[model samples]
Target chain A: MSRTGFQLPLLPGRSPSEPPDTQDRTRALEAKGASEQVGARVRRLFGGSFHLRHVDAGSCNACESELKALANPYYDLHRLGIFIEPSPRHADGLIVTGPITLPMREPLLRTYEAMPEPRLVIAVGTCACTGGIFAGSELVAGPLERLLPVDVYIPGCPPSPLTLLHGLLLALGRVEEARR
Target chain B: MQLTWLWRGLRTGVLTTRYPRRPERMPDGWRGTAVLQRDQCVVEGAPPSCVTVCLPRALSVEETGGDRRLRLDHAACIACGLCVAACPRGALSISNEFELAASSRARLISEHRPKGDRAA
Candidate 1:
């Protein structure tokens, strides 16, 4: 048997023929003018000052696990001047994970609508950015861009903690400065 | 950022799975698939315990004249390990061998019975 070509069966009730353009337009709109706004806010919140909020739409828990790992002693996201807030009102950015399942669409919209203006949205994991292997499933409503504007995207089956941190830093414009 | 990059580089080596080529290692107590021992099966009309434990109705027992027959549907199995535990005669065990890939789904089904053990 050829293991190289095996793929899990597509989730039930998914369309195999949907155009990819829908996702692209949404992503482009999200990326525009987002970095600049987030960068300004992050600059003011340096040194243990900013808080982030996380939402799990319908992920398999892999992405959420990695996100929580950031808070562990080894990663210590707090040391980088970042913290995860429980509420949208108190948050500067929204970290979203999962494939945005059908049942979660309304709740996700409600969460995004509640956040204050100049708020940044970061889509983490392949499930968030492209819905990964779940894209066409009836249970999933999106690649996230379909419902909410995404400022940054970090891709992986479930991205490593550092990859997520780098994405957050990119959104903050901290990595660019550090690059030079 | 240089410090972050150095830390990231060190961590990247540890992530990802080398699956497909090598048999993927499942977690402890992972239910792979059930194997049937033909020798332990009774050729008589005695009911097999595997039939009762399969939640998905993936297994069936048949009687041909006087022989007992057991059939299994591999695809319908969720690898729940119930049948393995239910086999009272030690005719069934759950094996770690998961590479049951087939070009056709029909090939995945399996049947077990003692050879030349005619039904009464």
Candidate 2:
């Protein structure tokens, strides 16, 4: 079997690419300039970074998978100065995923209590944000906000990595437009 | 360990997305945020199909003083697109937008007037 003509030629341009004469990058940068200002504010507030403690209240693990992807090479949250801490005491923010299960409620509260002052809570996914499909379940305690103050809410069955990044940035008071 | 691998890495260039700079490109047929078009729906003549098909209870039809309206709760939504497909009049659909983050939960709740009533 032959695998010819399946791929395009690599580097069709001349050796050592030259910058385009058109100002396309500037327009692209302008559209995202608001986020840059927000980044500056975030840096001023948190010293350019923040540590997070993620708690799986009671989810199907779908959200967890997406959250874990933030650390992967694709997202590389570390490049943005965001780190996930193992302990709540060392965390500047708390990222709660899934619905609040009955048994996990107390532990979740305790974890929140352990965090330092001026802490922020980000509710991730539909379940953690509003109980999702299991809203009325007797085994679950509903959304995380019922038990604690939620600073940011990320909505989706399992929000994409980009959405989560926006949520984190939103929590940092970096949102451009008011709401979606 | 080989020179070819280094060349390949250089050719691949940057993999990081230009998101927040340029919006992330959603996949083809991507379903993110769902919206309801009240003007397109026939709420008085037919039952709301979107409500019945929405497993998450994110879409609800509530009666308020002889008027029925649609309520879309962003928090409870999983973006399943089931409700969008169930709408007979094309009243509900998945939008390309994915930026659904908000500081206040109440801001995520949106209500639409029924077809028979004036849109608010």
lDDT by residue (tens digit), candidate 2, B1-120: 699999998999989866666677777667777877767866544457788888889888777676777789987887789987887688778876777788777889888775446543
Task: Give, for candidate 1 chain A, the lowest lDDT window spanning 10 residues.
Answer: A11-20
Error of 1 at A102 (Å): 0.9
lDDT of 2 by residue, A69-90 (tens): 9888888888777889999998
**What TM-scores does chain A show, candidate by candidate in order?**
0.77, 0.74
Winning candidate number (TM-score): 2
* Clashing residue pairs for model 2: none
Query: All candidates' lDDT scores?
Result: 0.65, 0.75
Badly placed stretches (over 4 Å) of model 2 are A1-41, A177-180, B1-5, B45-47, B118-120
Model 1, residue B105: displacement in angstroms?
37
